[model samples]
Target: MNKGLTAKGRATRQRIVVATALLTREKGAAETTLDDVRAATATSKSQLFHYFPEGRSDILTAVAEYEAGQVLDVQQPFLGDLSTWESWQKWRQAVLDHYIELGQRCPLGSLTTELGKSSAEARAILTTLFTEWEEALFLGVRTLTSAEPEAARIRARSILAAIQGGVVMLQATGVTDYLTAALMTSTDPLRPTAEGTD
Candidate 1:
């Protein structure tokens, strides 16, 4: 009985968090209101306060964590296990398609920016997301080579950096070409050896 109630409580809290993340993504962090969340989640003000006593900033942090998870969720199994060329291609397209569809409307980027780059909490969350994301990419690169673990890791970092930089440019220019170019350049260093090329 206690466990059931705890589960229900957790579900309710998650509902609030997800509702806040979606609304903030669509409306921007600064523009989002507790009333808006209350309305969207069909949660009462008292319930909202009970779940998040600190108000907006507390909820914003939870939303940040949620959005951070989603930023790479689209890549899925392919992102986690890139042992084949086909899987790598799938991961690449998933990333490209995601940003392309997102266009200039980037909820995750907006949330992080609003949170401020200098905030230690925000920076730590972003850093953890990037490291986890890079590990996935590194796994794919390692699958392509056996003798260069360190080199593959470094190359993977470069690819990740390029993609991030490209996303920033995409936000500004509404173009995916930069992202495409960056992915290409990052993968270039991983081409099969001359003997295997043929």
Candidate 2:
């Protein structure tokens, strides 16, 4: 989207995207309107149109990208450096905490739900998020286990799946137990006591 724009223009667009993301978080992507985004961001209709030429769909797409980035961003520090058992535990807690806190209001969940109604682009965005998340977990698993690379990869994917499944349940039931259990059990195997070590 940012094919060519000056620093100021990019910043303006980002501001709109961020505002739209927040609005989507509060009021589901399907319900948020361009007018609401404009009011929240204080951008005029022309300004919004300037940044998102295709109108609401473009803005929603940008917001989807923003929310997707956030899914990984929250797991940072621990997610980026899961070299030790402690880091893995912290990463698990981070994931659990995020979902538990948001519960039914999960922005990614709502955004995907709405986006799923209209385009394959939404599915692609979700696939990309999961793929990246799995890769990170895979790398982390490799660092702590001497398991074959393929085995570690499967474990990583399992961890990612556990997270997604737990999140769905959390959203449905407004409980953290599901996510906590999923993360704990999925990550317990990589604790370094079972096989490999630092």
Return the TM-score for each candidate structure: 0.80, 0.86
Candidate 1's displacement at residue 115, Å, is 4.2
Stretches of candidate 1 exceeding 4 Å from the true structure: 1-5, 115-119, 193-198
**Model 2, CA-based lDDT:** 0.81
lDDT of 2 at 109: 66
lDDT of 1 by residue, 61-129 (tens): 777777778887877977988766666777788888888888766654554565435245656777788
Report, for every candidate in turn, its global Cα lDDT versus the true structure: 0.75, 0.81
Instruction: Quote model 2's TM-score.
Output: 0.86
Candidate achieving the largest lDDT:
2
lDDT for each residue of candidate 2 in 1-198, tens digit (9 for 90 to 100) = 987978999999999998888777677777889899989988899998888999998888777788888888999988998777888888888887887788887765655566544356766787798788888888887877756899989999999888877877776678879888988899887765534443
